[model samples]
Target: MADFKLTYATMFNPPEELHAGFDKAVEKLKKNMGQEYTMLIDGKEVKADEKFDDHSPVNTDWVLAKMQKGNSKHAQDALTAARKAFPMWSHTPWQKRVELLRKAASLIEERIFDLGAAMALEVGKNRMESLGDVQETADLIYYSCYQMEKNDGYIVEMGKDPLVGYDARNVSVLRPYGVWLVVSPFNFPFALTGGPAGAALVAGNTLVIKPATDTAWIVRLLVDCFRDAGIPDGVVNFVTGPGSTLGQALVDSSEVDGVTFTGSFDVGMKMFQDFGKRNYVRPIILELGGKNPVVVSKNADLERATIGIIRSAFGLQGQKCSAASRVLVEDSVYDDLVGRLKETASKLVIGDPTDRNTYNGPVVNKSSYNDFKDFCEEINQGGGKFLVGGNVKTGGMFDKGYYCESTFVVDLPFSHRLWKHEMFLPITTIGRVKNMDEAMSIANDVNYGLTAGFYGSPEETEWFFDKIEAGVTYANRPQGATTGAWPGFQPFGGWKGSGSSGKNAGGHYYLPLYMHEQIRTLVK
Candidate 1:
């Protein structure tokens, strides 16, 4: 497939030529906005009786696209389609499956610019982050393919049993679940959608992907990539609708064999609970929300910690589940760390996401905007100091977009609701700790344990890694404190209440979860 090798988007210090191309691509997509899209079940487009308007989080005045409002019936239809295609697809040779997925990855690379443009507009992600999300999706698919090849299609011959000395043979094979339902989140929609979906397909399972309401168009692009690569009809289906109607239908179905979900803790946990009510146990892979933390020890380098904390706390407008929402600093470095962090936060550029220089973008929608405003107000009322930003930005482009300042607050107690909850906004709470021990205590005190970061010396860093209760951890990383996880480099997952499955996505253990083991004994 044209000598494909997956590489992440190089946004920093990128050649001027790349920027020129991206700018043109954005213009092209902007002109094509407002088209209507429908559900894809069994290779046909099925329009729903109801439709929803998708507006740009960057500029709500601009209609990005129209999506079919999928319902229970649509979910059932998609499931039926998947089941219908399962026999042939599951029997397809693993080598053939690998080739088709690789072709899809190549197709995604060919259309990377276009997809990135759509993502930036639809998700309010800056150019770099949007492009990274698209590239990461392609990488994730390639990784899954690589894993399939490495494992020899998960078909292995086993040793003969001691009692089977009379000419007996044993073999093990992993077989796909009947139908896999993929429910993706808005942030990193392309990657999260493609990653889990790829894992399922590579393992021979059929998929009925339910894209987030806001990101249906992006998923449409992804489905096209798979279809163009020659995946059989009904093997990969796409449906869009509200969670109350479509989501509930998919989860309630006893026919669905497995599900991969990425979203809020409340919803993910509920799905985990409901999936268990069936007559038999059904596999559910979930990456839920996180109230991640970053600890700056007394031995930390203040400059490094400040920059890392800023990036983690505000990147993607701090919408990432792995974003650092709480920062616990040792008392010795607390003043310096807070001072530098506020300075960096104040200097960060906030504007249109398509701009190459923009460091922050708008929140996903009006609800998030209101939540950010209310959180900042509460912090102020609780006598916390707003060392940098505490208000939303309005007027001009901000009038239509859900724009807000990347905020920082101090003097909030560890028991504050803001400290313990996941705001999913560009807000970070800073508190002082007596030492590394107390910092660890405060960091792990939250219910969620998705991701965490530490800035300290080698000894302290080792201790942090040993003691931290997160699934994903980073130390002294300038790119971010808890953010910036590349697929192959860091397999992402969560611990405690942040996730239902212990296996990390894009890691070695992920694909096995999509299938169940079948042991065969042949006596000769």
Candidate 2:
């Protein structure tokens, strides 16, 4: 595997050794299943009065782990620990912080197989996608450290002021905010949590991380890596529980200096409004859900468009914020492209994601499973046609878990709410357009501007890039239409309602979001 590099775009054809390693890790993980796990706060193991059992979406009969069900007190305790550690952590030299973060990234890569296996069972992602998430987390941290080093710890010598009979010196530095709170979503739990945590820590701030209820176990393993890398006590903390009690407490705390949250738009907006009620404005970075679209031109390559659309639409059961939820094709080749997509999507294997041959997996949990059914029913009532799949998979192994078939709909009116709403499931809507103008108009109509894909001639591709409202845009790529963003290669984020800071993660501009600028002037 030395000759190969792994990224979401490249994971489609990994070496045989990769599969062997994953198989071994999966076997080892099975033996350790159903253990009780505790939360880490201020370098101590904290247990809650109540606990919840985490069941695998792949097979609910298998209890993945027992996790602590923390309350508001635990959230405050974690925040307090981070606040207390802020002075020492914020004063630590940036170089030392970068060193520590790099070590943590190394540990993630070393444990990639184990982490990936647990992610597959817990998050219902396929082996390759799970491994990619783990690898991407490490790469994101590495990128943050690289940026810190490249910018010389964000310290720059500025032009000195000339004063009569005096020597003036001026310098500028970027300093960390106080304690930071990271609230991560269920999908890509490792990367989203670790990425923000790494940046906050490297920027000289302390942290308190809270994972989504459905995916606390995998995140606990991630926090372990940071602790094992010798991050100072109280500098990084982890908590688990319901969002209403624990997560809200963290957000409402006056002690929190900043926050980074990745979740649905409604929830994030509420948090943003609540956080704004503080005396002063605090930094709140958000990656809200997306209603991403794919625009295929009349002169586009039909085969490439079909593959990219199918992969982006159905990968991870289309639970990604960057998933291609809507496809707008030119009328000239709409039927051809739709037929190819239907044929390709129909052949996708669906079952336990841990299986080597499976390309599609179960939805994250029962809530999403039921939502999928409800959405399919709504589409049927609205006079939409199912091109491939629009039903839940039941009986046999699927009966024990939350499983849904990949679904694509067509002929729904443009005014349908489903066109703009984020389903966050294995459902995509495809529509025909009279021309590129019509396709582009409909694609940009949604509030989300996270990611978009285009397939067309050179001139038309250029037009799409110029006109699309999304932040991350791709053209004629078979790997994925709107998904498969890699750190350092394709820094992922959103625009408009899709994101808050207008900055993409794992790129040159992300680290500074965790910090503020300070200028020093001296005269003698």
lDDT of 2 by residue, 102-176 (tens): 999999999999999999999999999999999999999999999999999999999978788998988999999
Question: How well does model 2 score by local distance difference test?
Answer: 0.95
Model 1's TM-score against the true structure: 0.97
Q: How big is the positional error of residue 417 in model 2, measured in Å on the Cα after superposition?
A: 0.8
lDDT of each: 0.89, 0.95
Our model 2 lands, by Cα RMSD against the true structure, at 0.7
Q: Provide C-alpha RMSD values for all models, in order.
A: 1.9, 0.7
User: In angstroms, what RMSD does candidate 1 have relative to the true structure?
Assistant: 1.9
Model 2 residue 173 CA deviation in Å: 0.7
Tally clashes: model 2.
0
